[model samples]
Target: MNIAGDDMAMGGMHDEGANKNKSFGERLVSWLGRVHTMVIHFPIAMFIGAFGVELFGLWRQNRDYQRAAHVMLVVGALGAIVAAFLGWFAGGFYLWDRNPILMTHRWLGTSIAIFGIGLAYLATTYRRAPDRSRTVYWGLLGLMTLAISVQGFLGGTFMHGGLNHLAF
Candidate 1:
């Protein structure tokens, strides 16, 4: 195995140039970026809750749950966009080199945000469109759920020690 790959996998390397610059706006943006951790939960919870509500809507024949799910999807999508923007600030622009985990998390988070927005748009058109639209919406929501789970794991690895975070 490549020693360099091992080190990156173990979270042994990070943005070496971090916290070494000197710009007030940059520092403030970085400070705001740190809030990415907290702000991210809104979208996560919203998306999960939206899915739950949709499932309940089917089970209980409650039209209200469907409406609630739609609203949640909108909120979740907006939250995702904001969270991704802040995450970029948090991760910095270019200091990370050859760090796969950070790179993956950064792009994955961004893709999720874009996907969430698309899902949100679909939600808005769910009722007016054909049956295929509903199918696509549900299918995308299921995929989004899976993606969010993976995203959470990646973010968690940052704090808990990469692949071995659960080694007990």
Candidate 2:
């Protein structure tokens, strides 16, 4: 009877341990989900705002509006970096091998990150001095705007086309 009691106790302990592990994974997944939602919108908003400023600048030939557009691009790029990090983590945790869409999403996400980092570097270096030219500023804005367009297109494609895995 003593041996039977010992077996039961061990089984109880195993159940508790399993529950704890599961709870930890659940918490991590929940946190990642929240971060994903939080960081994604900022980039979308910033990119749209940057494009608006650029259009407005061209329409009015206002240097101030153009400068605002550059600032918005930089802010959007920074947000993209944060969102990519969280997205990468979540993809690895839950969808890496399970879904082709996740794989395509990861690739597009990485491309977006690289483009954003490059844009940020260009913006920072070019704007570091007080004597930066309006032309240079506009050029950087154009590059950033192009990157944003590509990133947005790829994101949409990944979502709508299922990574191009299915044949129509």
Candidate 3:
């Protein structure tokens, strides 16, 4: 996909000419990478909302909440998988300039996607079971949330400058 050229193209965001010589497939890859920025928010919000819904369901003994959480978890996980690959493509296009922060962000981002899938699987398998333990569910959700937070922080640093921006 000529990621090196992608880096160049991204460096000049307004250079329409930069993409002129690239093949249709290369252009499609670049377009998909650009979609990463827009699609990433969906999984973040859905995961957090799913966790909240599950917690409320547990508190109130509401089956509807459980069902909603199960659906959200599965959907969010699938969306996260898509976002993860798009993020990789986007990162390839980025001019990281050898910044280690980017490497950390990339790995953590991938982990978040994997964790999302695991959580979704757990949610699905236990969805129809009345004997499922709330503690285990909550614990897994907490861990996944933590991973997402860390990934978000690293991504923010890359976008906003200041690696330890959260130190305040």
lDDT of 1: 0.77
C-alpha lDDT of residue 126 in model 1: 80
Local accuracy of candidate 3 as per-residue lDDT tens digits, 1-168: 223234334332535666799889878777777777789889988898898898888789787898888888888898899888888877774535366777777777788889888888887778758687767878989788777887788777765555766676
Task: Residues 1-168, candidate 1: write the lDDT tens digits.
Answer: 322222123343434355476477765775666678779999999999999888888789666677789999999999999999988876666545366777788888999999998898888788555344366677789889989998998887764566677677
**On a 0 to 100 scale, what is the lDDT of residue 7 in model 2?**
14
Model 3: lDDT to the true structure = 0.76
- Off by more than 4 A, model 3: 1-14, 93-97, 164-168
Mind giving the per-residue lDDT tens digits that candidate 2 earns over 1-72?
111112123321223343454567665654564466457778868867877776787689665665676677
- Models sorted by lDDT, best on top: 1, 3, 2
Model 2 misses residue 3 by how many Å?
44
TM-scores across all candidates? 0.81, 0.60, 0.81
- Clash pairs detected, candidate 2: none
Candidate ranking under TM-score, highest first, comes to 3, 1, 2
Q: Regarding TM-score, does 1 or 3 come out ahead?
A: 3
